[model samples]
Target: MSLIAWSLPKKTQLPAVSLLGNLFVLWFAPYAFVAMSISACLVYLISHAKSQKGHWVLLGVGYCISQFLLLRFLQEHSVDLGLGGSFSVLGVAYFTCRDVHYLVESYKGNVRKNIVTFWYYQSFLPVMIAGPINRYHEFEREIQRRSLDFDQISKGIERIIYGYAKVTVLGNYLIEHKIQSYLTQLPNQESILHSWLVSLADWAYLYAQFSGWSDVAIGFSLCIGIKVSENFNRPLSSKSLVDFWKRWHISLSSWCKDYVFTPALLITRNLFIAISLSMVTMGLWHESSLYYIFWGIYHAIGITLCRLYMKQDNEIVEYLRQRFWWSSFTRALTIFYLINASVFIGLFYDGLY
Candidate 1:
């Protein structure tokens, strides 16, 4: 797919190729294609609408409807409003984000009014499933100036290799097969050490699995001369809960910051409320469940506390901040907090008490 896109005769034809490729991929999941097509049409029409007093309201309504459908599809597993077949749209969460991003950017006069380009952005195959959520402007620019080069291909292949190793070896083999199996066979699964180990393993497995796929998506994009946004950046090594969010799932976090947090902050003028709303939105983006809601709130509280602590002017705090080992200590502390939180959430959801 990368080769085909890269080898296209005219750069102007890139969007058409991308659109066709995405449609081809979606053909396997016809219902998803239909759903996404409808969304694309709506977004295009909204983008082309005249600037009016109710423009923002229209965008809000469309966004809310899309999110509602995402949550409903997640809960019900199908459209099922007399749509004959019982099939749900695949990658609904991702494509919805893409559409909303396009709509918002279009409103801001940042995107072209080309429907083909819009559809290409919405259905780009590499980031279609697990995305770094490439912005439409960046994608359009890349499509125009893409090249078939050796160095880029080699780097792309290397990234893909690293991603596969992380997914298969670290996530599947080391964690799933070895560590989890050993834990399962433990005599005292309720021990503190056991719990901590489980938490660490689970966290590692999730990072490996998610970052691995992101790496693959990035590699594929790079192969075609389009550099998408990165998804992760050593999140476990972050110095605080606040810092962790800046590194982990960076695309989504940044998106929420721009689209949710900033807007809420502007409206409410309250730091805690903004952070809480943003985190909850991020959490619900993964799944519309109480577990994820609490997961988001847990992190939001931690982040708020971290932010508060950073504002402290105490001498002891200053002394600690100036120490060489302070960063290492804080990094470890952050990882510990995240691990325990994950464990607690897992236990709560699984009723393991």
Candidate 2:
């Protein structure tokens, strides 16, 4: 069935088939259906509202509330706040992003308003769970331009294989098992190498897991004749923290830049505060905890410092460049800083501290 679908060029068949398959999977949790339905309805209303500015504000507030509730649920694990009993909304966080994109674009009169297309874009099963969060405009364009070319199909297949390998092999083995075990013994072992090893493994593990999910989502989207966003591109090779974010989680980072950072910067007229707020929002999106909060603040400071450093005079930059090992040294330092930060995130996630 999958092989035949891969070979076929019928655009309509894929959505029908994919939608039905996702519906079947969604049936396992009826509450998820209700949640998505409610979310979709709200999004539709926001998209079509007469007072779009007010509606957008209302939608934004609702979005934050939903995230807070979900975060609370994840933390407590046994609390019920009426959306669903003690279960995370399957794709609530991702959908919130899509919802925000739809609302903001529609309000700005930038997106063509189509109820049918909006529903399809919002609920597209492949990218729903873990997204390279597709924009409505881009998604619509891809759908219009979709073709079942051999190159696209082959690329999709290769991405799927690579993504599967990343998740199952590198993520599962190197980090989840081996490195995880090593970290658990770090305190007792009392070795700097062990600490560094844990941090390094965690940084790699996070990239492998999240980027693997992104690859799988992108690969499936491509197979179905859509070109969703790419989420990562050699983030570890980044020369600076600012550049690292540009390459990592491309979807979310771009989303925040467009929807949060830019607007906040305009409103507050303060780059530092705007950048800090963006980082904080990104961190909280992961989970609501002191650890995640600190993670966000930490990145914000890193980025702010980088920005300040770059503002130095041209002479200073030229002098620094004169040193033969300056480039290599800076690159290694950036990686080291990221790894150091990620160690805390890993420990937090694993409940090690």
Candidate 3:
């Protein structure tokens, strides 16, 4: 294979790392990760995939495939895997395509400038993974996005450190001490609360792992040259389950709202029917799994109830807000309710398989 030396001004370029840098940080072997990233990126490019949801599904599948090949088929000698190496393959492939999508949106009217500058911004690595799901129009403004200012830097570092501490300390304790033992021990079918208590640790562990990484990514983006979208908020603070969803995985919620819910709602005047269809769409979108269906149903019921409850006389939402002051007691109660409900739903349906 021939490699070409790229020449571009640092000012004009989107902030991303080199192939060699990707190799160093992101793959089982630099070569292997590079190959996987190339293949995955090619897959999206050739497919001309438009939606972020599609990209996420494809990336998840690609990661699974690469892991199977590297860990199952190939020996350790065949590849030395680092977390970034595997993550990079999935991450780079995703962001590369998203940047392209955003650029296309950015240059809706100017075809000439759009084509010329498309590749430059698209290949920038910062926005490529765990994205804000850019629309090309907005990205035109940030073509040569710069590093954070002092205030941004300070806040970003604090957020990153907080994220790291959450994952490393609290998240680690749950995983290493609680989750492991619980997973090995068979569920006591007699008392559901036993299962609920154990699984809550797993959920917290998952949140810490993912949120911690997301914070680090956000901090890294600021340290470099671009500001990406926020991923999560304090979801458990939600008054209702629907509100909880809005706070929790913002990207996925938005995707579902935009692509599935709104479209379905538009098609029919019947609220129940629209919701029913929306939930089914969400289930299939999550991958055609039984568990996803259950989750979708759970969400549909929750959303529907929330809507219906709001329409009733003396709305529960207004009552709750007016009744309870936002205090540690209320917040803890909200957390308790959400976690307890989620635990049963989670165990009742573990994996798609």
Indicate which candidate wins on TM-score: 1
Per-residue lDDT over 1-353 for candidate 2, one digit per residue giving the tens place of the 0 to 100 score: 24545555665565574576458437654555666667678777777877677657565647745754665465457555576544545666777788777777877788887876776786688788886888889988887886667788779879988998899899998789887886887674556567777778777888899999899888877777688878998998888899999999999999999988999999999988999989988987787666777788888989999888878878879899678688778789888888778665656657855
The TM-score values for the models, in the order shown, are 0.91, 0.88, 0.64
Candidate 3 residue lDDT tens string, 243-314: 666777675566556545665678876676667666665464434445656666666776787678657766
Better of 1 and 3 by lDDT: 1
Please list all clashing residue pairs in model 3, or write none if there are none: 26-84, 26-85, 27-85, 28-80, 28-81, 95-128, 102-136, 105-137, 106-136, 106-137
The residue pairs in collision within model 1 are none
How much is 84 displaced in model 1, in angstroms? 7.6
Looking at candidate 3, the ten consecutive residues that score lowest on lDDT are: 1-10
Local distance difference test, candidate 2: 0.77
**Per-residue lDDT of 155 in model 2:** 90
lDDT of 1 by residue, 176-265 (tens): 999899888988878878889888888899999999999998998888777888999999879898889999999899889988899899
- By TM-score, the better pick of 1 and 3 is 1
Question: Whose lDDT is greatest here?
Answer: 1
How many backbone clashes does every candidate have?
0, 0, 10
Local distance difference test, per candidate? 0.80, 0.77, 0.54
